[model samples]
Target: MSEIEQLLRPELRGRTPYGAPQLDVDVRLNTNESSYPVPDAVVRAVSAELADELSGLNRYPDREFTALRTALADYLATQAGVSFDPEQLWAGNGSNEVLQHLVQAFGGPERTALGFTPAYSMHPIITETLGTRWVDGQRDAQTFDLTVESAVEQAGEVDPNLVFLCSPNNPTGSALPFEVIEAMLDAAPRALVVVDEAYAEFARPGTPTALSLLADHPRLVVTRTMSKAFTLAGGRLGYLAAAPGIIDALRLVRLPYHLSTPTQTVARIALEHADLLLETVEAIKAQRDRIVAELTALGLAPVPSDANFVLFGGLADAPATWQALLDDGVLVRDVGIAHHLRVTAGTPQETSRFLAAMSRLVPAHMMTKENP
Candidate 1:
């Protein structure tokens, strides 16, 4: 390592960086992005706005993001079915930036950030980037569910300052149960519980959102995005719902001019046509069901998922499997955890392409292990 690399934030010296694939495949199911395109109406609006943009480029963006914040607060309120004052809201380029602001505000030498493993891989990377130690609660290797007993034990053991729970947890599409969340709330009342509901819109009717529990849990913060079910991955908009105090802290840490005008306009239009976009979400959910059913028939053990992607391990020689799929113009993700692989739901044609690729890659023995 170079001398500078050695001296660099000691914790970050050799950490592997997050690497997203740079390819175009027939079925690009690696990242958990919606395969749907923006509604033609919204795309035209975005284009028109871009055309109308000021040539001045001299005046900085609205420093306070005042108008954008108002629009976002109103829109998310309807989507979440929860009320939030404008003072209780803020937006960033993406939820990832919002998360970083939280770390900058709270994570430091002694403060710890807590979460579960096999989470959004970005979680640990973000914690390490802030020089904060990451403490995680264990899960059943077979099923990625957390128990109240285990969560409480970790709270006492690690004493983390911030705890993140990704409901409809990423990579593995399991939703952290309400009981488990209640137990963690009981266990770590002092810690900030960040319930990341990035895929909440895909959740079934009875599943409760962090917003539902906020009435009783003051320290809870729920961050959501328009990228998943809203089909706005390219929009770069994410929001948070928390108590006034926590929101105030985030407001203090973030840059003055954050959410851009185009982002605000597009997000507003997306929210307006949500019922239409929800058709896409329903289609994706149906697509996920078909994929899961097919995966099971092919003898892969996909964990029950409430999100867009499903995960399974025991995939035969994962790198070889991945390469095999690549050869056939079908690509998927081999997130390193034994034979673990994650695949996203896409349009029917995309789904068929992925299934054909799977037929080409998986061997008999690994298929047996995945099933039995």
Candidate 2:
């Protein structure tokens, strides 16, 4: 082993860091980022907020981030139809940081964190790297569905200290049945159940958010980000809603002035102009459904999606098809599933480029019933 490798923490010694390919392609739809740019008015507001805060850079940011939390609470009340007090809100660099806070405070040596496989890849990475045992729970092999029965059973079996659940789950692009969230809370009574709702704004009508259950479930947490629907991926703001007690616990683990003045200003101002910023959500959803339809018509199988991406299958070789798409000036995610790839819903033009590339590769690159 190399000197650095030998000196690394034993658990992280050989693990690859989590990232998607950042290639230069005409249609870059690998990461599930909003393909839209910030609206001009929202940009100007953020700029103004930052300009006012620039003089205060020498002073540390508000350790409590009081105003940002209030803005976040108001946004949630408006968007989710669920009310929250500022005391119940927490913000960090990204949802990833909020998630890490959960682990750092509640998960550690000898503790266990559990998540169903093929969900967010970061759940396992974050859990294991923080000196916690990661239990790779299962979802249905054929449909990628997590039944309430299956989740309850696994949570009961592992008895983990933290459980990670993603709604409109990453890679699969489908929301968990809301029942699964409730069942998991009961199944793992001791575990803090975290629902990562990074794409909540893009959910199809009638989809429920865990935020609604936060009033009754103290152990429940729903994390959201400005990166996707808000079109502020560069702003690096993610926040969560949980019981006040859970929010209190996170403060114990967070660094002093963790939310910088600029980050706070950008996110708060973006929240104020959320309606203008989210104008593209419906357009992106249209493209998401279109990708599902087109992929299906081309004889590929796409999981119905509630998020701003589609996970399609029937590839003869996923990595080869990913390369083929990239070669055609488009890029998609080969999410390590045997014959499936995930593609983010981008602008209509980008969607056309990706579907055209996929259509060209079909029959040659796709799996037929005979192949299966």
Candidate 3:
């Protein structure tokens, strides 16, 4: 073994870092990012905010990120109808860092972190990297649904120290039933339950957020990111809402002055112009529905989605179809599912190009039988 490899932690010796391909293609939809660019007004506002803070770079940023936390709390109150005191909010470089902080605080040697399978891959990565045991629970084999019964049963069996629940889950693009969250809190009474809502802004109408349950459930934490709907992925700001006591626990593990002055300024300014920034949500949602409808019409089975992307099956070979689409200048995700691929709901033009590419590939790449 190489010197560095030999010195590395045994668990991380052969592990690859988490990343989706950042390919340069005509219609890139692999990652569930906003296809729309930041509006000119918000760009101008961020530029101004950063310009004003340039001189302050010499000093350390606010260790607590007070103003950003308040702005986030305000945004949550307005967007989700859940009021939160600033003390109930915490943020980090991205939701990933916030998640790591949670693992560091609650999960460590001999402790266990449990999550339903085919959910966020990072849940286990973060858990195991922190020396926590990872329990891979199951979802419905065909439908990928996690019922309250299944969740409670798994939690009771694993007795984990942390449990991850992803709403509008990645790879499948489906939201968890609310009852599952409640059942998890009850079943895993000793565990902290984290609901990753990175795509919450794109959920269909009438879908409820776990934020409403935070008041009564001290173990519940809902994480949201500016990377998806906020069109601020470059800003690298993600925050979560939980009981103030849980928030305090995270503070114990976070590095001092974690949020830079510029990062704090940019996020606060973006939150200030949230309405303008998020105006394209309906447009994106329209494209997401179009993808589902059109892919299904093409004889693929797209799981009903509440997020900004669609996961469709029925490919003869997902990797082959992925390459065919890539050759035609459209990029989608091959999420390691044998017969399935995922495409982000991009701008209308991008969606049209992706659909057109799929249409042309149907004769050779689409599954002929009902089940491939």
Candidate 4:
């Protein structure tokens, strides 16, 4: 092995960093980022907040980040229809960081974490990198469904110290049924259950959030980010709602003053004008539904989605279809699934471009019974 490889942590050596291809393209949908930009009014407010903080950059940001946490609690109360105290909340650079803080506190060399496969890729990365053993759980092979029976069985079998669950799960683009979450908690009695709700704002109507279950479930954690529906991906703000005790545990692992002044200011201002900032949500959801309907009409199988992206299958060759779309100036994610690619919902015009590109490639790249 090379010197640096040898010096790397035994678990980390030969690992690929978690990221999507950040290629410049006309219709980029590889990452599940909001296709809309932040509103000008919110931008101006953020600018004003930052200008006021510049003179105080000499001082470290609030170690507690009290103001930001209060703002986040206010937003969640309105968004999720559930109330939370600021003390019951914790935040970090992104949801990923909050997740890391969780693993660091609960998962270690001899401890284990369990996550269903085809969920967020970062769950495994964070768990393993923190010196915890990772157990690969499963979803249905055909439909990607995690039924409560299956989830309960896996959790009981693993008896892990930590469990990762993704609602509006990544790459699959579907929300987990609340029954599965409750069953998991019951089965893994000793495990801390984390529900990554990064796309919570985009879930379809009638979809219930895990946040509602926190009143009685001390082991439950529900994390959300401003990167998606809030249209503040660059702002790097993510927070979670859990029992006060769980929030206290996260503080033990978080680096002191880890959130900077600017990050706090940007997120808080955006939260203050949350209604205006969230105007594009309906538009994005419209586009997401359109993509699913159109793909299904084209003979591709799209998993029913509650998130802002759609995972479609029936590709004869996923990588080749990915390049074909990129060549047409529309980039989607080839998530390493055998015949599926995940595409983020963008603006109406961008959606048209992606669907048109798919139309051109389908006859050649799609898998049909005769073709197969």
Candidate 5:
């Protein structure tokens, strides 16, 4: 092995960094990023805020990010009907960084982190990178659903120190039944259970958020980000709500001034204009539903989604279809499932382009029992 390779941590020796393909194409829906651009009003506001903060760049940013935390707490209160003190909120560059913080603080050598399979890919990466043993928990192979019994059984078996759960789970695009979160808390009493709600704003109406459960369960952490429904992916602000003590633990591991002044300024301004920024949510939901309807009509199995993306199965070869879609100036995610690919819900026009690309591949690429 090369000297650098020999010197690297054994756990990371062969591991690739997490990323989805970022191919340039007409309809780019590989990542679940919002297709809408930031509103002009919000853009102008952020620019103004940045102008005011420019003179202060010479000094270090607020070590605690107090104003940004307050804004996040206010946004959570108004959005989820749950009140949190600023002390109960913590943030990082993205949800990924916040997740790493959790692993760093609560996970380490000899501890274990458990996450259901085919959920967020970052869970295992973050766990293992922190010298924590990663337990690959299972979901239903066919339905991709996790039941309370299954989750509890796995938690009991592994007794993990950290548990990662994703609501409106990535690639599958379905929300967990609230009971699953509660059962995980009970089963893994010693574990810090993180519920990633990155796509919470896109969930179908009546879907419950774990934020409400936080008042009673101190171990439960509900993480959200401005990257999704807020349409601020470039802003790189993600946060979590938990007990004040749990939030305190994260502070111990986070780097000093981890959130810069500009990040704080942009996020606070965006939170102030939350309503205007979220105006396209309904339109995106409409497109999501449209993708489901159209894909189902074409005999593909699109998982019923509560998020901005849809995971559709019954493709003969997911990677091949991914390439075909890209060739046609459209792009979707081949989430490495054997017969499934995922597509983010974009504008009506973008959705139409993607659907049209799928239509062209139907008889040749789509799977049927007879063909199989």
Candidate 6:
């Protein structure tokens, strides 16, 4: 080990890092990216704003982001079906960074960060990097969800300083019930509960959102992003809705002038055409439905997803199937969980392309019952 590695904490240096797959293919469904391009109208609006604002790049961007922050809070309040104050708002480059900020502010070597396993890989990454202890609740794979009983039990054991929950969770794509989240709140009312809604837009209605309980729970912090369903993945905009006190602490740690003028302008412009973005969201929902139905027809069991992607397993076919898709110029995620693969709900054309590739691998007999 290098001297720096030696100087570093011994426990952390042994941690295994998260890995993202890099595939060589045309139809890329590895990342849960919305295949729909931004609407023509949004593109033009962003261009108009960029033209008006780009000249100011030489000057520093807004440190407070007064207008952009207000707009974010207002729009999120309306969309999340909750009331929010601008003072309760915070923004960062992405929710990944925003989450890092949370761990940094609330976590320490002595304090533990609590979360469930098989979640958005970033959760464990941030917790460990901050040198905070990680207390993980167990998962229920048979039901493909987490039980509130498990969450509460684990929280009581660790008495962690923070709890992270992802609705319609990453990788697995299952939505935890609101009651489960509330039970978790009851268990650890003192610890901050960060509900990551990165894939919130894609979740079907009636699914639970943490925003509704934010008013009653002072320790709640809800983080969201414009990257997934918003079609501005490259824009790098993430925001958090937390109590004013939490917002103030994060603001204190924030690097001055964090958001660039272009980022702020583009996010605002994107918000203006909310209707246009919802259309793409609707299409993804439809595409997701089709993907699930078709995968079942092929005798592949995909966990019912409330988000923009689905996770399925075909132990017999996983490796060969993944390689087959790649050979046929399609790319999908092999997330290292044996026999399981994650596929994004892309546009109709993209779905069709994937179907074409998959049909070639799934055999004729397995169309009714999974071949052992």
lDDT of 1 by residue, 154-252 (tens): 787877888888898987888888887777777776678888888998876678887878767878888888888878888888877777788778867
Candidate lDDT scores, in order, read 0.77, 0.92, 0.92, 0.91, 0.92, 0.83
**Local accuracy of candidate 4 as per-residue lDDT tens digits, 193-307:** 9999998889999999999999989999999899999998888888889998888888889998999999989988999999998899999999999999999999899988889
Error of 3 at 265 (Å): 0.9
The whole-model C-alpha lDDT of candidate 2 against the native structure comes to: 0.92
Q: Name model 6 segments beyond 4 Å from true.
A: 2-19, 22-24, 364-372
- Report the Cα RMSD per candidate: 2.2, 1.0, 1.2, 0.8, 0.9, 2.4
Q: How would you encode candidate 3's per-residue C-alpha lDDT over 45-159 as one tens digit per residue?
A: 8898889889988999999999999999899989999899999999999899999999999999989999998888888999998999999999998899999988998898999
C-alpha positional error of residue 252 in candidate 3 after TM-score superposition, expressed in Å = 1.4
Model 4 per-residue lDDT at 13? 88
Give per-residue CA lDDT, model 5, range 137-246, as digits (tens).
99999999999999999999999899999998997999999999999999999999999999999999999999999999999999989899989888899999989898
Which of 3 and 6 is ahead in TM-score?
3
Instruction: Give per-model TM-scores.
Output: 0.93, 0.98, 0.98, 0.99, 0.99, 0.93
Point out where model 5 deviates above 4 Å: none
Between prediction 1 and prediction 6, which has the larger lDDT?
Answer: 6
Cα lDDT over the full model 4: 0.91
What's the lDDT of the predicted structure labeled candidate 6? 0.83
Model 2, range 64-96, lDDT digits (tens) per residue? 999999999999889889998999999999999
- lDDT by residue (1-372, candidate 6, tens digit) is 889889877877767766556666788888887788888899999999899888889999988888888888778867876878788888888788899889989987788888887888899889888888887666886655788788888888878789999987988888888887888888986798999989998888788688888888889998989888898777888989989999888876777888888888888888888778767888888988899999888777788888899888764657667777888888888776767788999978889999877777776313234565
The stretch of ten residues in a row with the least summed lDDT in candidate 3 is 363-372
Worst 10 residues of 2 by lDDT: 363-372
